[model samples]
Structure formats: structure tokens, C-alpha cells
Target: MRQKMLLAFAAGAMLASCGESENAEGPEVADLLFSGGTVYTVDGDATVAEAIAVRGDKILYVGSAEGAKAYVGPNTLTEDISGKIVFPGFTDSHAHLPDGGDTILGLGLGGLTSAEQIVHAVKAYADAHPELPAIMGSGWELNLFPDANPNKALLDEIVPDRPVMLVAADGHNGWVNTRALDLAGVTSETADPVNGRIERDAEGNPTGTLRESAQGLVSHIFPKPAVEDVVRNLEAGLAYQAGNGITATIDAAIMHDHNEAAYLEVSSRQDLPQRVRLSLLAAEEMVTSMVTPDNVEAVVEKLVERRAQFRAQAKDRLDADAVKIFVDGVPENHTAAMLEPYVNAPLGPDHRGEINLSEEALNAYAIALENAGFQIHIHAIGDRAVRVSLNALEGAIETNGERPRRHHLSHLEIVQPEDIQRFAPLGVTANLQALWHFNDAYISELTEPFLQEKLHRWIYPAKSFVNAGARVVWGSDWPVSTSDPFDSMEVAVLRKNPDDANDQSWIPEERLSVDDMIKALTINGAYLMGQEDIRGSLEVGKQADFILVDADPYKVLPEDISDIRVLRTYIGGRQVFSAAE
Candidate 1:
């Protein structure tokens, strides 16, 4: 679904086989037929077929090209896709959609390669929008700067008169100019808020970098993106997901953050491009204050009722059944709840970071929510947060007894070895962003030095989780990173940047096979979305959600995986994207 035309397949073998099948016996006439190429079903046994027939939105046939001919009729739309590599339409388990959409509409910084370009871009954007009180945008990398720290001075060089606020590509940190910081009244004297930091210099002067929750200090001053703009942007975001071959996703933080309005707007038009799962944000206070043993059932009852009510209005495309909870912050800011003190504890020597909720509160909410039938999508980045979440899941099982649930923990950034095995037995999914598994310049400059050797080594154990029998799934966490599925697939298999051949595999031992990575992106992610049965694989009865790639990933070089192009994307047998178009 990515945007790019690739007539890369051999001109001879490429499309020679997309003709009607010779077998003419079956009564089931296919509405559409694709023949003479490899079709990776990603089914239970991982069936690979030479042809596929679609009748309406469901797959009508998948078998040898000759066998598929039986399902073809006079009116069937057939394609000779012999040269293409077919795959299931992808699913992004964790993405901030409306926000991802909004970033694209902002200063448009994602494609810029240098800091100088960013400074000029900001200045140009500021000059053009003088009526705006402040400028805000995202998509800047951290490794481009010294110590992964971006000072406000760069923006000051261009727009010293206006306030400029921009976030890092990861969305975990923020950089602002002095005018913006001053408008927020954030100075050396301003104390770091809970679960955040205001990076300072040797003299304790604000360095213009805000980590985690500290971004909020400057956020309040910027004009909110109008509701209409947000809706259009969100609609654009869903199309972007489709462009990346993503047909489904859990918009990680939706309704609770006021994204529901935009989602409802899209649904009302019946223009939703993908199957979206609305993971309503559960405020930290919801667990810390609202849920207790005395009122746990009552709070859960109300939450379930609200979810049912929202679902009734959201239409079939957007489902509201999951709750997103943040257990801790990211490792880059030292706000991630670690089991032990950091190697360089700038906050304090004894500080080991803290969780957003108490153990008792998390336990109560998880149990009640599970019993009430809500999918819990937990953001557990630090080791302690991972452990705390596992404990909560364990308590949920002990209380309600193990049952079917798509409950998952996203961003298992650091999972202790002892707790790694707990996911599978607990039926918990390891919702991973493998794109961040590499040991990059940012890690060397900012994160590695701050983590204990053992903890640092435990980063992104995708293989360990897979080996531990845990249900492994992949998520883009877009706006934080690129949503290109192949990029993450390459990282999961190589554990390094696919573009840099010289880069060492960060942890070669933990690398997964290509097949495992594919399953994680396809079936596993669908499992997390609670649509595996109907949407994940290309089974006969399943919805025809699949993609066609220009080259076979299995036949390509390990590092060249990301370069493979998605030629087309289909959902429910309906073509959603075509690179050639």
C-alpha cells in the first residue's frame, strides 16, 4: 500500500500467469481472480498458493492456478499477477491516528534530512503564518544532535521573535525556542513535573528540551488544531495507513483524548479506510483514584456501559472495546520505570523512576476490567512497568480464571528474563515496536549510558518473547516512527537499520526468521485486534485483506527487505491502493 510504482518484476515471468484457470467445473463463480503468481495465505499451516479467487469481500478459492479456474465465471474480474508477491493486508497494533494525521498537516518536517533544513522550514512556516500565536509540529530525529539533545537555540536562529515548538520523531521529547519556553514561563526555576523533565545546562538554565509530560507545559499556549481540521487530517491519516498496506489498527489513544469526534465524523460518512479499534485512553487518575476494591465493580460497570454506548454510535468500521493505560514513560527521558537506579541518575542518585499507578490500583483495575470484558492495551516500556503489568495480568487470571482476551502490552522496551515467559501462559500479547530495536547513535549518546548493563542488554527481546511462547505482534507506533511494515520486519529479522549495510546486528541471537516476522505483522497483529478469524490470513472463508509486493521477500537479500515495494493493497476484496495508479 506504500506509494511508489515498481515495474520491477521480470517482464516475461512477471505477469504471464494472471489468466483464467483451465478447470471449469465448480458452481462457485469468483467475482475476482488472481492467478499465475505466489499467494502467501499466512494460514495456520502457512499455505502458499499459485492463485486466489475472491467472491464479494470473502476469499472464494486459494489453490493451484489450475484449481482456481473452476471458480472463474464470465463476469469475474481477473488479473495476471504472476510476477507479484502477495501478502495479507497489514495491521498496526498501536498507532496514534488523529495525531499521526495532524503531524502531516503541520510544519511537514518528516522528510527533512538536516537540522539546517528544519530551522529554515520552521522560519518559513512562521513567516507565512504570522497570525498564529505559536508554531507547533513534529517529526525530527534526536541522533542528529549532540547527546541526542536539541537545544532551542537552533530555532532561535531563525525565528527569535515567535514561539516555535517541535517534537522529536519518537514523540517522547520536545524542543522549543526561548520565546515559546518563556510564554510557558518555563525557566531554570521551573520544577520538572511528574513523569517528565526539563533538561538543563551546568548552570541549571533551561536547555529548551522537554522530556515526556514536560511537553504539556508549552502545549497549552499553542492554538488547538480546529475540530474540522482534525477530522480531515484523521481521514488523511487513515488513507496514509492504507498506503502502507495497513487495513486495520488499534488507534492506541482515541476517544478519551477527544479523538472520538473525528472518528465519529469519518464513520458517519462511511469513509473509514481501515478497520479501526478505538483504544480509549484511561486517565491515570482513573486507576489511581476512581478504582478501588470498594467501588471496583461499579467503576468497571460504568466503563463497560460507556464502551457499549460508544460502539453503538461509532458504526461498524470503528470499534470501541479496548482501554489504553500508560504504565510509565520512555527510556530516552529516564522516566521509564526501571527496576534499579539508572547508571547516571540526573534526576537524583537514588531515583529509579516511578510508575503512574500503585500496584494495588493497577491490580484492582486489571481484574475488574478483564472480568468486565475490556481489552487492556498497556504501555509498559521500562522493566518495572513490564513486571508490574505482568503481575496485574496474573492477578486478573487468578480472580476471573484464564479466558479469551486480546489484552496486550505495547512497547515491551525492556522485559526482564524472569517475567518474559509469563506472557504466553497468561494469554497476553507482546505488542512490539521492533523498529526501535537497533543500537543506534541515540542509544549510544542518550540511553545506553543511563541504563545498567544488564537492563540495557535486555532491550526489545522479540525472539525471547517468541521463544517463551508469548503471542508476538508488531505495531508501527506511527508519529513516533515510520509506519512502513517492511522497515520493522527488516529490523525484527536483522536487528539493525536495513539502509546501513555496515551496521552490526544489535543482538543477532535475538533475531527472528523472516516467516516469524511476517506472521507477527499479519496474523499476530490481527489477533491483537480481535479480527484474526476473519481478517488475518487468506483462508477460503476469511475476508480478502491482502497485498501484492513487487518482489518476494523470501527471495530477496536480508538487508534489502525494506526496499521491496507494495504494488497494491486490498481489503475485503476491494482494491484500496494501487501503486501504478
Candidate 2:
């Protein structure tokens, strides 16, 4: 038949490419050979191959099964991956791996939809671990509660004796019981810190809700997790990522001083399964103090020193070449800086949120870091914040000359039309959380009212950026959102809540194609992390990082993408995870 003839020709081509003798070979040679599957190369041509061969940690050949057989020696480990789909291992462009791990191990509040569920879960956890000195947890959404603000009295009703503090889903707010507030000495007179707020009642009493930088007040009182605990949580997180098909991730914000050491220790012991890029926290103090002209030089010098120290102690598995900066807070808290006035400001109609760092200061800081050979990753959640971040990066590029390093702006929740075009020309990466572009309770209840008319116009302009020739990358911002790439991809393409598929798609015009979403999760993420040449695609000579899926994402309905589970995961020619095993 014609099919048989085509197969034979493809096999012949593979044999020719491998340069192996079919008749004289005692035994072929390769560390591993995977055959009989649809291999998505994700290369320039997006070629689909029938088989692939790996030698040690590198891919030796990618073609037909006949070609791969040439490299199959006596020691080869072969896998017959029939009726499956293979893709380049996913990379979460931005995530809080350690925090996610900690949350999983501690009080997990990931998917609860109501206060009753959260309270019941917390109470159960507290009862199970009565030996603990204090209780700490996160993953509570503001929109889940009435008025988008959680009350401390609810937490007090459960753990009236032991102190309890739970962080908001966004990681920008915190809720604590009365005992926790007392433990932190947070009285009504405890003035709010710069760039942070302590939400209070009408009577001027502390409401037990802390926003932005103010969470540090109570956090400082909580006992730090032991080093072993930290490592254990990190490993748990890495394993979770691998199970979900992630081979690489960037720890977006390294806030604690000991986190760097923990990462280095893990990398040295070869326990880290995924490639990790760390962006150290440089925004908290710098944003508050760097506004003064005299303070800019000192702040930049300090950042440069931190970079040098990290690089000197860097390991091969972990990279520390970027710094994370927060431009403003989230819109739910009314802290995200906006160019125009908020629709109904509590203080006044003219109030338009707050900007942590001025435009000039951000520009200077970016320029200094860019000149010192470092990439900048900024969190700009509002329209004005996004514009200011773009302007700062532009100023840096103009002043320091365009370098190979590509700067990133994350959480593009609201980007102006004019700013959408700036990304391509300035070579800026739109690091977006695709899972957020949907009709979720957070969007419909908490965020939409504030934006008023601008709500539809400014929410996640992903397609616009891609059309403008800008490289768009995807991230989960885990511990803040779901880290599953499938979940994110589904939202990106469908523009609807994956949990409630029947819900109407929000801003469906901005939806992306499956192909574009795949690129954002794989190649684009790799490029953002500066690992494009070595990984990202399933090409020969690249690191063998890939995963086997239960179904083909391209062939299935877009809504079913998130339902397709990862059957197996491989890195450096070694099997790292398997559903069966």
C-alpha cells in the first residue's frame, strides 16, 4: 500500500540521518529510545516526528523509528509510547514554588469557594495538629467573601486560643485572628507602614486585614520554617510541577534571605528536578526609598552587590540573573495605581490608587540594573502601572543601549491600547497569567465594578500583543493562582472559567489559538528564562526535557485540554515521573 511505502521511505531517511549500518551492528547504542508516538518538535517548522533517540542528557536523533533503532545498543532502554502525545517539557515562566510547597504541606485552601468551607478546613487542620505553637495558611480569595473583605472574627470563632494568620489568594493581603494581632502588638494606634495599609473598622479598630507591605508586621512574629522543612516543601513543590509536566520554573520573588541558600543547597545535592531561575526581591525597600535622587545610587549599588553575590555562589541547575520589582498592588485591594480616577473612591472621587515608585525612579533603577548585565522582571497589575513599567524599560533601553537580555512585565491585568504596541518595539515580554482572563468571581464581582467602562477595554491584551510581534509568555504565579499549564491554556483559548464551562466567556475577542497558547507555555517561557538554545524544543542537540500526554492537545476540543493528564515526564533522557510507576 502507499502507506507502507511512505513508512519505508521515512525509515530509510532516519537510517541515513543516524549513519548506522543495519547489517553489521552488534547492537545499537543510545541511553534511551522512545518510539511510536506523536512527537511535537515545536521547532521552527513545528515538525511531528515518529521517534526520538537520546544519549546521556542530550537528544541524539529525532525522526522515524527505523532511524532511532540505529542508535539502540545493548544497553538501550526503549519505551513503546503508542497512542500518546509528546511535547517539550513545560516551563512555568513565573511561580512561587517554595510558597506553593509550604501551602500544600500546611493549610491548603486552594479551591474552596466560600467562607464556610475555609473556616471548616482551618478548624479541621488546627484540630489535627494541636501540637503546633501557631497556625499559618494561605489561598483564601477575597471575592469568596461578602464585600471582598474577610473578617478576623470568623477566624477567631474557630481558633480563639492559638494565633492564626491566613494570607489572601493574591498574596498581597493577610487575615489574622485577634490573638495574632495581639501577638504582633498591632493596636489601633499602630500606624500603617509606607506602601501598606491596616484595614480598620468605622470605629478605628484594627479589622485584622492587612494589605500590601503591612502583612510583614504579623509575619515577622510567626516562627520561620526549619531549613529541612523548607527543603522538604521545595521538593514537594518540584515533584508536583513534574507531575503536571513542568520541567523548568522561575521562582518569581525570592523574599526571604535564606531562600537563596536553600535553593543552592538543593541544587548542589542534585535534588532539584526542574531547571530554576530565581528573581531576588528588590522592590519592597527600593520602591519605598529609591525615589530620592541621592538614594538611587545607593539602592542600585546594593542591588548590584546582591546580584554579584548570587552569581558567585550560583549552581548549574539554578540561575540568579534577574531581579523582581513590584510597581503597585492588586486591583481588588484598590492599591493598583491607575492613570484615571477610580469610579467611586472611598476617600474622594479624585483618588486613583497609589504608585509605589515614581516614573523617574523606576527608569533610573531599571537603567542601572540593565547596565550591570541583569534582566528585570516587574509586577505591574494596572493600566497606569503597566504604562509606567513600559516607559521605564524604554528609558532603560534608550539610556543603556539595547542588550540581549529581555525585560519582562508580569500580571498585565490592564494594559492600555497604546502600551500594547510598545512591547514589540521595546523588546519587552508580556509575562501574563492566562488563567485570569475569564469570567471568574474575582473578575465579575471584585474587579469589574472599579474599572467601570474601562473593564473590557483594558483586561489582558494577549492577542493584541502577539499580533504586534511581541513575544508573549505565560505563568501561573502559583500559590496566587493554579500552576497547571493546561488550566491556564484552557482559559487563554476559551476565555471562560474552566471550573464552570457553562459560564459566558469574558472578553472572548482577546482569546488566543491553541497553537499560540502552546507556544506561550513552552518556547516562549523558555525564551523568557534565557534557556531557548538548550531546551524548550525537542530538537537534536538540545536537552531531552519532555512529557507524554494522555491525548493530543491539537486534536481534542480546546475545552478538553486541561482534562488531558500528563502520563509521564522525562528530563535529560531520564524518566522523572510516570503515572503508572
Candidate 3:
């Protein structure tokens, strides 16, 4: 009797009467109904409905709560969502998120912002677990050290006897101690790999820091965790994403074959709740040791096999059909390939940093990958890096002609005006990392000075890309930075630090509209992974993937958008994450 009264009251708040005059047989009953809430249906018209109805895994009706009542028969489950806000579930287009779960299981270094804090935390973790022979942890911020570089002495002071490996929050660089280096036998005589760096001092001795592929040398030595341990971390990470209102992810890196086992193990248990599109990475060794005109056939064959293997064995929504290319490194380390030299050129006057592969080689590789049916996802930061990656995609198109592939480029940090227009014509999606658009400590301290005023103004041109008719999308790059979609949407709309929430924007003209951000966070991202036809929006026939937040983003101030909390997340009309629980 109480439930009936509540439902009747909620039905009063329903939208304008749609099919209110039901006939003799009555209206079709829906299995589930959500009413008395603001539903931001990110559809073609951007409809704001008072109720949404679902039957099984697909959306049945999205109209007035009064209309919804006709579908709410005795067997229908009803939710009176008064004062709540609903939106399509967010898709983190590009992220490395296994760390989200791994951090919870063992030693985590997320919030430590100081070097002293990090070293002591490593020492404390080492002390607490003396049985471990090596210590490994991530989430070290770049602003904590000079030029995002760290050496061994501080860590050596703490645990000189044990092997210590601390990875930067961005996952591009690594810090190690003397013990680990000695174990790897990386002396001054050890030459840097083709696409990596082993930071050294004036005397050419290893400074205990590794960048790019160089970290792989020592990281391969760490003992592998048990299969069950990996499955637990994978589950925890996926749930963490769901808790943040994310229903899908384009996992930006898959370094080895073993990485597949844990994800497969979890999927076999029917525990996989989110859509994952893994981007298989090509290491420096593979390009140098295996790729050539004569051996390219075998290289292409291996790539195809791996992509097919992941797609074929799926108990749940798990897939891998994309390839990842690190065209250059980040500017903080002076490894990003730029058209002009960085201010005061750290390496040399004419130096513009590293380019992992020659343009010729990249063109060949791109053509092969595309011909073999793999979408390419390139990491290009500097202006020159962006140009070269674009050139490679252009070559792929000319060689293989056009099919249906959503090839994309991530981290367009310093795109030139000419290249900005090239993205749409060449058919590449500008996968914007919107969270980094602001003038934070990292940008204020190192980035501004490094790029200077000239090139710095061109940073994260969100509106410009959209104006150029390029399909733009946003990503969290989690484990590198914050993964909250609200935090990211806030930054994209304000072009200022969400935490600061100040009036002084980074580059005001680049600020996106609220509608622009919602589209990027939803449909645009789904299109990038080829799932737009099924999900990405709330409509009559689409999958029931959406979230209920604490407040309506449209009603809140731009600065307060980050304060919106995810109350409940639903995928396939089934509850996956609930904050109240």
C-alpha cells in the first residue's frame, strides 16, 4: 500500500500526457521504469524527458511519467527518482586504468605530492612487507621533481638493499635505485635503446631514471602476480570505473600477451560489466627486430592473430582490435618531437626531441595495419609529432583506400593551425585530453617556460578543432590524472582548473559549451570504438546504459559541475554500481 502511494505521487510529476487515454487491453507493460527525474537524453534532439522505461536490456520508452505509468504494471519494477539527474553513461575514450584496481590491492602512491612523502611511503611499504624482494608502485606526479625527472639517492637512503621501482603518474617515465640498476646490469656502458632513454649524469652513469621503452628493460624482471590476484585487480578496476559513471573505455595500452589472461579470466566468470577495447602496443624491439619489407608479412600476420584471438573468446563484452603507436614522448622530459626547438633547447640548439619512428617506416606500418583490419591509435603530443602521425594516416588512406575505420590521434597538445584543418580532411579524430587544458602547477611551472608564449597559446585548442569540423572527444587518461567524467566535463567547458574554479580561464576561446562536452563524453567516444550504433545515447531502441547523478549538470554553475556525484550507474538496464551501497 505504501509503495502504491509513492508510485502514484511520482506519476503526478510525469511529463505532459502522452497516450494517457489507454484502451481496453491496456498499454504494453515495461519491465522497469524510472520516473520523477530529469533525463538528459543525449539524442539527436537532446530531449529532456520526465521518465524512462526499459524492458530487459534495451530502452522501451522515454517520455512522460504519466505515459510511463501505463507501462508500469504490477510486475514492473519502479524507481521514484525525485530530484535526481540522468545521463548517458560516460565513455573514457583513452585511458590506462588497470592501475585503478592495482592501487587498491597493494601499495598505492596516488595522493602523495611531495618527494619526501613518496620516498617515505616507499620505505614504509618496504618496511611493512620485508618478505618482498622488489617494490613497485605508481602515481608520482611530474611537478614533484625537476623536469619530471627523479634520481635514486632519496630512494637509496630508504631501502638501498632492496630493488625499488617507482613509476610516474603518467606511466611514460620510471625511477629506480642502484640495487635495481645493478640487478639489470645497466652500467654506463649500456647504450640507450632505439626509442627510449636511460637518464644519466655528466659522467655518463645511469641516474636511476628510465623513460619510454627503457623502463621495460628492468620491469620485465619483476615476478608476475598470481592469476587470481590479477583477476581481482581487473574486477576492482572495472567497478571503480563504473562507480565514476563510466560504462566504456578505450584502454590505451596492452604491452604483452599475458595482459589478456586476467581480463579473459574475469570475463569467463560473467563478471565483466563494461565495454573494453584494448589497443595493442607495438614496442621498439618489434619494429627493429621483426618489421621490414621481407618480414612484414609475418609481422602483419602476428598482429592479425592477436586481434582476432581476443575478439573470438568473449563470454562478456571484451575486445581488442586497435593498435597503439607512441610517436613521441612528453615535453616535460624534452622527448616530444616539436617543429621548433624548445625554449633554450635542453639537449642542443637545433634539438626538437625524439621521434620514435621515421615517417617512411610509419607510413609502411600504418598501411599494413589498416590493410590487416586494425584501427590505429597514435600518441602524438608535439606539433611535429602530430604532423608526422597525420602524414602516416594520409599514407594509409591513399594506399588502402577508405573503409569503415575510426583512426584517431590522442594528446594533440600543440597542434599547428595548418594541421588543425588537416584532421577532418584526413579523417582522424582529435581525441582531446581535456583534463590537462588548464594552467595547473605542471603547466605553469614547466610547460609554459618550456614552450614559451609563442607555442603555448596553441595548447589544447578544443573549440578550434570543432570549428574545423573535426570530430572531437574527451578522455580522462586515468592513473595519469583524475578519472571522474564530471571533473573532465567541467574542465572542458570552463578551460580552467576545476579545483581552482577561477574566472581566469587558460585560453577562454577554447572553452567548449556544455552540449559540446556531453556529446564528446558520450556519442563521439562510442563512435571512436565503433559502438555508436548500439550505445552512447538514451533512445527508444538503444542499450540501457546510463547514470543517475546527484544534480543536473545543466542546472549547476560551470564551476560546481565537478561537485556532481554519481549516485547510481546502470548498464544493460541492470544495476552495476550504486554509491549508496
TM-scores vs. true structure, each candidate: 0.90, 0.93, 0.93
Q: Write the per-residue lDDT of candidate 3 for residues 1-581, one digit (tens) a residue.
A: 00110101111232443222234796667888889988877766666788888888888888787778778888999999986988888889887756667776777788787988998888889999999989988888878887677888888999999888888877778899999998988999999976678999989999888987788778867777777777777777788899999999888877554456676555444446688888877554311122444555676777787777666776546677898888888887778889988887567677787678777777888888898888899889999999999998998888888688789999898889899999999879999888888888777776768775788789878999989999988888887877788888777877776555334688899987777788898989888988888889878778889999997666677777778899988888888999973
Q: Write the per-residue lDDT of candidate 1 for residues 1-581, one digit (tens) a residue.
A: 22222222221222112323233553478999888788877776666778888888888787778877778779998888867878888999989888788778767677677788888888888888988777888888877777667888888887888788898877778899999988889988899876577889999988889887788788778776667888878877888898898989888875444466667666644446788888766543211123445666766776676687666677666787887778887776677889998887667777777787678878998987887778998989889999999899888888898688778999988889989988988889999888888987657777788888977778888899889998888899997888998888778878886667678889788887777778888998888887888978887778888888887877676677788778888888888887873
- lDDT of each prediction vs. the true structure? 0.79, 0.80, 0.79
TM-score of 3: 0.93
Give lDDT for model 3: 0.79
lDDT of candidate 1? 0.79
As a whole number from 0 to 100, the lDDT of residue 113 in candidate 2 is: 81
Which residue runs does candidate 1 get wrong by more than 4 Å?
1-26, 111-113, 202-204, 269-271, 284-306
Better of 1 and 2 by TM-score: 2
In model 3, pairs of residues that clash are none
On a 0 to 100 scale, what is the lDDT of residue 447 in model 1?
78
Candidate 2 on 1-581: residue-level lDDT in tens? 00110101111112123222233645336788888987877777667788878787878787777767778778888888886888999988889887889888889798898889999999999999999989999999898876667889998999999889898878888899999999999988899988888989998788889888788778878887777888878888888889889999988887535565567567654435788888877644322222444577776677677766656665666777888888888888788888887776464688677778777778887887787777899989888899889888888878877568788999898888888999989989999899889877777777777776855577777788888899998888997887878888878877877777466767777888778877887888899988899989988889889998888777667677778889888887777888973
**Quick one: RMSD of model 2?**
5.0
Model 3 misplacement above 4 A:
1-26, 269-271, 284-295, 501-503
